[model samples]
Target: MVKTPLFKSLPSRDRTAAKKLVAPAVIGIWIVILFPLLYALYVSFHDWILSQGKIGEVNFSNYITVLKDPLLLNAAKNTILLTVSVVVLEIAIGFGLALLLNNKRIRLRNLYLFILLVPMLMPPITVGLIWRLLLHPDLGIINYMLSLVGLPQPIWLADPVLAMITIIIVDVWHETSFIILVLLAGLTSLPDEMYEAAMIDGASAWQKFKFVTLPLMAPTILVATIIRMIAALKTYDLVYILTRGGPGISTETISYYIYKVFFVFLDMGKSSAMAFILLAIIILMTLILMRVMRTAEQ
Candidate 1:
């Protein structure tokens, strides 16, 4: 005898009831998320202006203009650099902290964990403001410490390269706590039998981490990396508050550039096109990462 499919096996009345239960959520999602996204896609194809309340001819010209813009190009480059730098540093530092905290002999581990999480708890804008004050050139504590150590004070948010570095450092400091929390949870959930077995087989610490811990932690690492990458790609608050995309627009990210185009330049069409492009890039990256993770799992 052939078996019935799961959905087919359900009673028609039950199926109808389930659909009724799910209808509100589906409708809400379409109204709140899908409708705006579809509207944005529509707006992206036109030459739109906010003050005049006019949407000019519908065409691909907006996309073409955005793609050819020098500011967009620069912002794209800076965004990629920032995302890569922050994600890598955060992973390394967070993993190290997690390993330290995972130690059975560590005292006051909870207190240390709480302290480490303080940065992540603060609002992004607040963190940016605090770091801005801390990194102030002449009167800031950072420069004062440098002076005390016989080091010349360099303008952090003024120079292009240093500005980028400063942003990256601030981002890492603020976001690394998330990675540490995720990795620590993953480490805690891992079974101990594998480590015991490795120890029985005379595996060294590094060998155990390499052969045992990493394999189990791969999914967690991928998840943390993806989360951090998405956040880094859309970084605007920190850049806005810390540097305002100044120092010759050296630290301007894609999101910040989009904001400038929409508000500062008041170019709605181009900004919408750029926003769609950014969304596409993010979706593509997320898909690639998910595929890689699935392949690793397999």
Candidate 2:
């Protein structure tokens, strides 16, 4: 056989070192993340109950019951609606804000950006509490302002439609900063030469944005959308603090429903089954988003 180059042996050594460096992280992940997921999966199939204090027979009854539950169905529908609406609105508002901040004529752009990011920095529970006070029908500043403007003050959290709208609004306020930050970074990184080329071709503002800005920003947009979508799907803290899935479950997302089942009903098996279903849905959404991102890249 021909003598192998010393570089080939060096490559093998580097590979071994790389594996050694990565092995601890991989094992840690298995212990911290994968192990819990596997345990949850195992428990999901069994008739486990808090009160029973024992794992019963393993079967699909938990999943079957969850699927047939009308409340769960409603919760799933609400979650989908909330996720879509919040993501769309967040993208729109965030992009607009990013564009405004990117304007060369704007003064104090950094200050404005900082102010907008403050809401996102706040804990969800704190944001919810603040909004709850503002949304209070009786003494809320929001209603007071509406009254000043001679507008009728609707029950923000008590009305089903309004409750959902309120939740969406709160979510948008808290999360749009994330989208704004991502889009602004994408905008800032875009090569100025592309805009100059478009200008040389006599492209209008709308044309440049439609053809150049959007295509380049597509990946960033997809990332922000997917993150916000997943967060919206698993929304609980704000909902719990603000409405507690009240107004007859109008604002109850699947996560909140699962919490109620797990803690309130103490149905560990059904809750785990629901949790797994939610996980599957989130994974499916993530895959779909990745596919879309790939298409956009192409």
Candidate 3:
């Protein structure tokens, strides 16, 4: 057997050309990512109100105030709940469906996948708007159908708990498609030789899944989860269009709350501070996912 080196060194001319090709991307990153991040950090430490139309004096206690606010705490709690629920639900459902479709016995797999992916392909804001109208108490098709069936037609986004639950259900429906797509790709790309070996060993279906599939699929699952979790943490458009974090802040997530502070309340400094906090949170979660992926790979 022969093994080949993964990387090949380019000739000097090719190397120079490669550097030139990558320079624009690096510059774009600096302009798009680094500059805004630095500006946000700078703004976070100062007292700036949009109404004032100026970045005011530096207020070192900005973070302290943000941390102390009860509403911030509430929003953080809501965000955590929403993120955890949606991620877990999406991953479980997506993986199950992916496994089902991955089986050779499954017919019309592409059609099923196409239908499932429709929600995800649509704009998130559009999904939210459609769901909002569908769940409307008076005129919604959902409630009208419920009335026809003699079932109770509850206000989907009116009550606190129900509003949160409504948001979660809608989110799961919208985001699960992404997880399925990613995990399905991973499943299809897995080496068939390993499965053949498992079958030769007389491994039971459950055992094959537990020992063979799970271990191999762990990293892919973690990657999908990390992407979804980051997006969930920054969720605002859906919340904005659907509930607007209404029903007495029941569905108010950190991102939506931050948006309100930044735009509605016109508190740029506080909003920037909250945004940084959320960014730190996302980075921490990504690091944790990376660590888990490393362990799984090992």
Candidate lDDT values, in order: 0.93, 0.91, 0.92
Cα lDDT tens digits for candidate 2, 34-131: 99989989989988778888888887788888899999999999999999999999999999999899987999999999999988888999999999
> How far out, in Å, is residue 221 in model 1?
0.7
Residue 245, candidate 1: how far off, in angstroms?
Answer: 1.2
Compared with the true structure, the alpha-carbon lDDT of candidate 1 equals: 0.93
TM-score of each: 0.93, 0.92, 0.92
Per-residue accuracy of model 3 over 1-298 as CA lDDT, tens digit each: 6998844876889889989999999999999999999999999999999899889999999999999999999999999999999999999999999999899888899999999988988898899989989999998899999999999999988899998998899999999999999999999999999989999999999999999999889889998999999999998888888889989888899999999999899998999999989889999988988888887778
Rate residue 206 of model 3 by lDDT: 98
Clash list (residue pairs), candidate 1? none
By summed lDDT, the worst window of 10 consecutive residues in model 2 runs over: 4-13
Q: Name every residue pair that clashes in candidate 2.
A: none
- Candidate 3 or 1, higher TM-score: 1
Show where candidate 2 strays beyond 4 Å: 1-20
Give a tens-digit lDDT track for model 1, residues 1-298.
Answer: 7986677578889989999999999999999999998998898898877877788888788888889999999999999999999999999999999999999899999999999998998898999989889889877899999999999999888999999999999999999999999999999999999999999999999999999999999999999999999888899999999998979889999999999989988878888899998998899989999999999999
